[model samples]
Target: MPNRIEYYNFVNGGYFWHHASGETYPLGILVDQGDVLSDRQPHGKPAGTLIIYKDGNVAVKELLSIKSEKNVWFAISGCTILPKINMTAAGFTGVYSDIGRTTLRPVIGYRKKDKKIIIAVRPSSSITRAQITLKNLGCDFGITLDAGGSTALQVKGKKLHNTTRRLNNVITW
Candidate 1:
């Protein structure tokens, strides 16, 4: 916890620490989320995007519609705290984690509290359940993006080491 910033009481069924500039940042709770736009079978590539609004909100999303061209998929989540990464990248681009085959994979994305980074995990099959868990754990809002190895969390222009590939779409800041 050298670069410790803040703390999230409940994340991925456990508490998580955030680091920034070799020091952890102050943490906050996840506040809001919605799967209204998350399309799994997107006909288009689902980039799995995480957005932090200027108003202080963070969200994970699907870039394209696996279902059809007209229908796009995206999972939006808002939280009491969504930190922004000072540097790096975001998006699941390839097969790094045991996805589709594994049970619960890692959830890589962003936090808004001290603008630090955050990563969470959920089951492989359903992103909804993960959302529910995040909700219960102070992260009242959060959406499931394309999990598995395709999950990536970025900062600035560089991608983090724990980044995942095999994604369909990706939204940037």
Candidate 2:
């Protein structure tokens, strides 16, 4: 039985040796089956990292707050688009800007009633709009994935949005 889904993008920005050819390395951590494939700590606090375990458990935690565990399978790190605290409390203000700006938005959230993870790609919306949409959809907690031109969402070999720019990382279920 599969407990959760996994997605991969390029990498989070961080300390790295720049290539003369203009190729940049991923600075964040990527763990597979308890084996670390890439492990470069991010330079600053990002939104957070989504951790998925072998038992079908999922969590969105603060940057650098999580320690490696035996049952942990993998994780995705990105700038904290939305924090868990705001999701639970519903007090969204000053945490985000560009409310009027619209772009492709990718989001991950947990629906407590359904006890399932919700993955969505909003065709065009701002962070504020995304928050309102997620709240209305009954998400108890959520976080924004990479958005703007880097946004990409695919299901069953079908592309949800046509993104020309190559993404550094992605999350899938």
Candidate 3:
């Protein structure tokens, strides 16, 4: 599949950030051929990061040791709200305690057996609930993506959900 970053200014009917800056930004990092297009430093340590290699391989890094190298094709960062490392759900109860505050939520997970990335955009869910869902989906590792109004997912040419806000960046398969 071809991977490229596409910019959008409006979603669901509102501008991203509620400002008309006319400049599009990625909600997460965008790396192409090891070139870092954009990397949003996590507020603290990222909840998790999904790394896509140039050789068409994918991995979910749960620790804080992420680095940019020549083989990394893409990297998107998100608060590790629910880390299912080692097949155990290690939940986070810090600044992202709004796990019950449901809205549009996006999550990235790794199915160890298939060695594939599982991207899901939930209509309404909290981090805790999302973690459980990921676990049930057999994700050995998972991380919550930038959600709320920024939550969005598109398959083929059809949008899974609609948001009024535009996004700075997007990760595509």
Candidate 4:
């Protein structure tokens, strides 16, 4: 069956996740009651502590509690991912949930489940449209995190890959 949530092994590549409390719903921007971030916008990751799984192990890396990049961490699950060819949406960043600011949150991170890495991020230009597309593709549900410049995928604990400026939200592959 097709589902929006996925699991992974951090071996091939890690994935990202977006969470928000019971905010932005029906419109359903936030998934379940958990931490969330706008990857498309470079504002930040989840507001709470985020655990990073590395190299297909149970070890978790806690993202430092800071206001800068040091606090930023990646999403690693019991899944593996193959190198993905980024389509677009790069060099963008944004503040958390502030529409007045000119920024972007990119979907950086992957989950390896069912032989695929599910990336998470905010919709680049049009969130509504992006959600529509994902729903059409069987996403059904998704959380809107930071997009634009903030959207970045990190692999191997401290390495970043994939960045562009085409579709700020949603995983291309």
In order, what is each prediction's RMSD in angstroms?
A: 14.5, 7.3, 6.3, 15.6
Off by over 4 Å in 1: 1-50, 57-102, 106-118, 123-125, 151-173
Global lDDT scores for all candidate models = 0.34, 0.55, 0.57, 0.28
For candidate 4, the TM-score is 0.27
The candidate maximizing TM-score is 3
lDDT at position 5, candidate 4: 16
Each prediction's TM-score against the native? 0.30, 0.67, 0.68, 0.27
| lDDT (Cα, tens digit) per residue for candidate 4, span 1-173 | 22121222121112233336422211111111223333222222222212332333211122222233322333321111112111122112243224212333322232323322234433343444434433444432232334444355444444243444222123222
Query: Is candidate 2 or 3 superior in lDDT?
Result: 3
Q: lDDT tens digits, residues 16-51, model 2?
A: 233577554555555666665565444433335566
| Segments of candidate 2 deviating more than 4 angstroms | 1-24, 65-70, 81-101
Task: Judge candidate 1 against the unseen true structure and give its global Cα lDDT, from 0 to 1.
Answer: 0.34
What is candidate 3's TM-score against the reference?
A: 0.68
Estimate candidate 1's RMSD in Å.
14.5
The C-alpha stretches of model 3 lying farther than 4 A from their native spots are 1-28, 44-47, 62-70, 81-100
lDDT at 80 for candidate 3?
Answer: 50
Report the lDDT of model 1 for residue 26. Answer: 15
